[model samples]
Target: MTTKPAIIILSASVLAMASRVASDLGGEVHGFGKRVPDGADVTFDDVAAHLAGLFQERRPMVAVMAAGAVIRLLAPHLGDKLREPPVVALAEDGSAVVPLLGGHHGANVMARRIAGVVNGFAAITTAGDIRFGVALDQPPEGWALANPGSAKEVMADLVAGASARIEGNAPWLAGSSLSLAEDGEIDLITSDAADAAPGRGLLYRPKRLVLGIGCERGCETGEVLALARESLSEAGLSPQAVGLVASIDVKADEAALHHVARYFDCPVRFFDAARLEAETPRLRNPSDIVFAEVGCHGVAEGAALASVGASGELVAAKRKSGRATCAISRAQQPFTESNLPGRSRGRLFVVGIGPGSDGWRSPEVTQMVSRATDLVGYSLYLDLLGPLANGKTRHDFDLGKEEARVRHAMELAGEGRSVALVCSGDAGIYAMATLVFELLDKADGPDGLRDGARRIEIAVSPGISALQAAAARAGAPLGHDFCTISLSDLLTPWEDIKRRVSAAGEGDFVIAFYNPVSKKRRTQLAWARDKLLEHRPVSCPVILAANLGREGETIRVVPLGELDVDDVDMLTVVVVGSSNSSTVKTGDGRTWVYTPRGYARKEGTAMTNTIPGDAA
Candidate 1:
């Protein structure tokens, strides 16, 4: 069904005529002047060479030949390598442009484009023919065909000389719209009736959806959006393709959710939290707090899936503000098995291998690795898991090249293999799990990865992240409300990083910074410290853990004012404690770090009840 454009010339005379027509039609022409005029004995070799030249230059070309004869001559050469050309046969009198090949591959469209220049008519085939309309299958870049069958029907109507009615949510398509003749024998209709005449087409459907979601607490909205996209991708849908956004009632006031809704340029409809809870499919390992507060699984994935009903399915889920937010869209069409992984079902595990150490690696993660058919990760990560990846197919790339690694893993898993994409810490924490869903959301179409019948399961097994381990090793600096930030500007911009640091400092929150500094990126950490100093005291405790849980590891604490930016590198994690965090020196001259229990009064009261001297 894939179409390509090409040009076929039946004879020397026809080739010469086509060259003249191409020039008049505003297309670059080749291959007619070198041969004898009126020569009908043209070989397939000559035709193919000219066609190949056009394709090599990435331009659309048409072949001039009789339909039946051209198919016979080119059938043997019609393998994938032929690079389809727009085939237009002359009818002795050049009245029409016929697109025999690549009807959708730009041949038919190109013919029309050229026909306008040559003052000729293009013979297009498809339904929903309107004087001016865009093909459903051929949406603009960044937009996807939500319904291809409908698109084909519309195009077929157009080719049958019928006109169409066009409607859209926005006026973006007006300028680039195609044209049909005023008297093209087509009618426009607004009704969705099936009995509408050949020329009648309806552009608007009120049932088309737009979903907006919000969450409680501090759940990251970006993560939720990623999950929602995954679900939509699984159903072969797009955010832009939906008419409205359906989200939880609680998120109606969330700034982040509003930001996303604005970006999508859609209306947000909030549903009752109870309704969302009632509709959410029960998961065995639901986060308790999420279920209790949101009356459902609070992940955007669950909410979006529920809001869309069975039609939209689940695309994303994330916990925010003690509640979960999700966005849902109605499924456009039924997906096929070919759209999913080739096998019956497949599993994608986002495993956090744990701060580059086997000892800290969870047993569940080890088992998952051992059971996997393929292992995908950075080369260093793959090397770290070499012992566990003995029999598995390894797909190793470079550090910071996570997108490619995740893509390769998805491709393998799409083929029905049990694949695991590796990450350094908790898979859910700044790891492959989120990226996997993001990629799924942004997939172009339902091409062998949208089948709902095939199981596309993903799970994240928690492993100790550097921040957690570093905090534990350096005492209880993380015993209170805290947050983790990455100083690496690879994904997030520096402005965002600075803003987050400033926010955390103002909130008096402990901050764990990953990717603190590298050879090329030295100033960010210094900038971050200066921002933090705005809200924190000079003597605030800052713990630095370098090569944590690895050979040549170092864990030390320094005052915020004394922190040396030069000492940090990619492998270092910096933990900046709140102003209240302090250091205690033991009699043995070893320094330990601790944050006040905040329950000191209660502890003192307990001591008084037990022993009098202990109270002092």
Candidate 2:
């Protein structure tokens, strides 16, 4: 199942440690302080209020603070232990982990899971867990208890050494520590319902039922809900055993169907008509009306049978109300998100993670990376994702394998997996986004290597490009009309790059040069500098910012005449000023570079302590 992410709340003092802790647990980290670390996925101003909100929403949380502080902040909102989300408190030093609330709902289990990561002690105080090493009330994963209020008395009897008899077939009962007998006073019936006497063992319901629903447009939510309950009741099926609600994709936005799913608190799945129609031979009620209207033989019955796969049997056929129809099917195994029908036809996320700094990375990029099942990028770019890439299948390539990387991402996405193609700076600017489109456009070539590339869903999320970072570092060199040009002749001819540089220089546009120089290509930056000197004065301000927003970063403004090729490298972005660009010295003795944007011509908007006037 696609479980909700845990909320890891951290104080300012332990922001870094908490970020690592959240990444290790694959949870979202929320920081509370004046200046929390950038590693925190969320930041909050009020700790007490936010904690209360999380509690009200029933979101599982791990507060990285003293247990006493967590208790003080959360005590007011605590109610209904059975319905509450797990709240675990950890020491700032990671020495102790305590399950403060919802031990059965998963706080104790979460604490022990985190203890394995942080190498700390899980202070579990539950009596059943301490003695039996299992929660009798909380059924195993994927199993739901029909009536949990009945668990207390049965657990008490078991604790008092009462013998019990297993009445139904279940794999879990075989290995359980329950005192079993052929005929006992306490009967542990594991069937769909409890058929034994009133005061008996628990009714642990396996999630084996799949409810398929179809509704007319604008159907009432109440009618859909009523029909669903009636169908299950008529089939002698327990409503608690329903695991999935499936329908045709055409009904994905149907409010009535979704309302029924919300009532059950189960995921609503949508299958395409093609997938639903494939089960026509197995469908008990193949409707010509449904086939003509929705291009499917059956929606309700077909969706249910499709969800449970070939081994499943339809227990309840289609039952209709005034506006909706419902069906139920039983599966040999419980339905999970992974095995659900109508899987999405892959998505390719072209993400740009900024210049290797955690703080500079965009939140959208982080979210995309977290959701991606496959991460395809260069080795260094993948490393920049750090702990976020822990569970994702990493397809790391060397620096020169751009085509291979793009192809791998597209193929994985074609296979219906969420894939992220990572780029260093902005994916759209001198990055992978353009290459992805180019490959898509050229897929019908002689080699036919990129067939079906156009069908996959693609998205490009912008990031802080190297030129933007350089301009920001140099104090707004890109304030006016400017253009970016890469000097590398790897793809484009050197003669073409030289012409573009000359044209940009002649037009007096502030130019940012990318891929300026390398070990073999040493003189491109110098050659471009000489061309810019023709249009701008020898004393024009030129900002050479290397490794901007990353380690060992440096930003310096030099005269056009004093531009040095030896100091420039492929990693540096050289932002050359226009002829009208001016530099002003700040009080701290650092130079600020900016170009005029004609604000001087307007009234009462003159630039002060900075460069002013239009180039004209």
Candidate 3:
């Protein structure tokens, strides 16, 4: 399950001591209200309750108290929800502030904001946050511990209450950017706009910015920050106004955690692991392992969500990845009373069409397409769904132009237009569902876009992938532990593909191969076979299934060594079995394939009747 970001606020003296505890539990702390002596022990229930209550109301609040008051008033509220406010306790000497709740959820955020007034540490807990000093819940919604080393300076600035000017659509501004100045005396500026007058805080909002991050298996803090810099440079945005950081979740403990937290001076939100399994919206023709597992969808969604305003549209579906797609609203305010119908809200669908045949297309997908005012996809994919796209505005582009298509789709959806992005086979399986989330991650467009975008609703439906169709055609070859691999090398390198294939082979797992061959990519299959031969016997059964649910469908079985590569193409699927596979040729020359259950002998008790009958 994905972990939610949290924050903790407490009084100052207690804050100094509790900071370690909060960080140990992966939280940040803020000290507020009265200050207490150092090393004082306090009960934390009341503070905890108040925070829970605040969260329930979706209101940003933090509890403040002194160290003595913590044990007296705060301790009682721990078990009950206290609106889940950001809680912070201050010390009498004004030396420290401790955040005890909602650390990532804003406790530390509140603490740092206050720290500027009092001149103290925000007391962030996570090792990466403390060392690099980042607030976990700041910006870049999907970045976590993947890069923990880069947060030092960012957190320091926030603690100092340095004036921060926001340039682009800042979701943290709530409804009005101007209101931010009123609430916190912060200034907002444009990317190219001149810096604020001396003594004023500056936040430069560039028209575009990207934060790319790379980390070790558990990424470090500095590396995460370095990657963020790289992405910002690539996107032509200043590092100062980076609104968010985006990265995979597996490295949540690495430098990415601190780097992004400090960079945005905001919380680091984590994406769903299943969602991150895929690639981002801008990526196409991903590597074989990417398609075989989750594709680029999650990365795209994380990027879009982090960059885009809170109110964005999920313009595309997950494609070739478990990752999702999203688009930011370019609008400036809430969308209301627009010329468009349906409450001026947008909608997103992760539609799945079973297999490639039109007959297998789900009714929901067909309905969504028919109701859509616009369509988005690669030219070939759009053409495939042309029948359902009559009268709809089409955002058609080349095979690899995914980002452009997503941007266009979000713009339309934000305008309150219903739209559907087409995907072949299941939208979730190497399809378009994940891209919708990626686009949403960075949706910080105009006011109309923001208002309607936040109102967008998203849904996903199930569909049959090629593996299932191929397996059924080949007589239940997928009944056991099986894995799927795409031979395509668009996004993944051949080295990674080889490793996965080798692992699956060594594990004695059944395998399904998709995109086995294309006109330009022929050697992958041959290479795969050679690798598999290293583990399995020459006589291993290989089922070649072509056009399984479509016309000209054919299923053939051959020995691993005897299989012919020329007979396979992009449309063909190969299911290679383990040593248990066997073929039974019927007397009539027809052949049936089967795998033994491996069941042993059965024993039972029997009663004798002959003796009893003779006696009777």
Which has the greatest TM-score? 2
Residue 109 of candidate 1: its Cα lDDT?
66
- The local distance difference test score of each candidate is 0.59, 0.79, 0.52
Global lDDT of model 1:
0.59
- The digit string of per-residue lDDT tens for model 3 on 363-384 reads 4565566456677777766665
Worst 10 residues of 1 by lDDT: 604-613
| Residue-level lDDT tens digits of model 1 in 1-616 | 1122223454455555555565454442333424532322112335545454444444455555455654565565455423555455444345677766655555566667657655677777633223444544444332334334455566566665565434433333445344444454333222111122233342322234334355554556676556545545654444545444555554444555555555555444455556656655532224567677667664444444554455554333332323444444343332222221112235677899888676677756865675578888887777777445655688888876777778778777655567888888788887888888777776656543333212355667888998888887888887666899988898899999988998888766789998889888899999989888776677888999987787888998998989999777778899998766778888887677776645222211112221111221
Summarize candidate 2's per-residue lDDT along 293-355 as a digit string, tens digits: 999999999999888889998888999888788889888876566666665446799999899
Q: By summed lDDT, which 10 consecutive residues of candidate 2 come out lowest? A: 600-609
Off by over 4 Å in 2: 1-64, 68-85, 92-96, 100-105, 112-207, 211-242, 245-311, 316-328, 337-345, 440-459, 489-508, 518-531, 586-589, 596-616
Of the candidates numbered 1 and 3, which has the greater lDDT value? 1
> Which is better, 1 or 3, measured by TM-score?
1
What's the TM-score of each model vs. the native?
0.42, 0.64, 0.40
How many collisions per candidate?
64, 0, 175
* TM value for model 3: 0.40
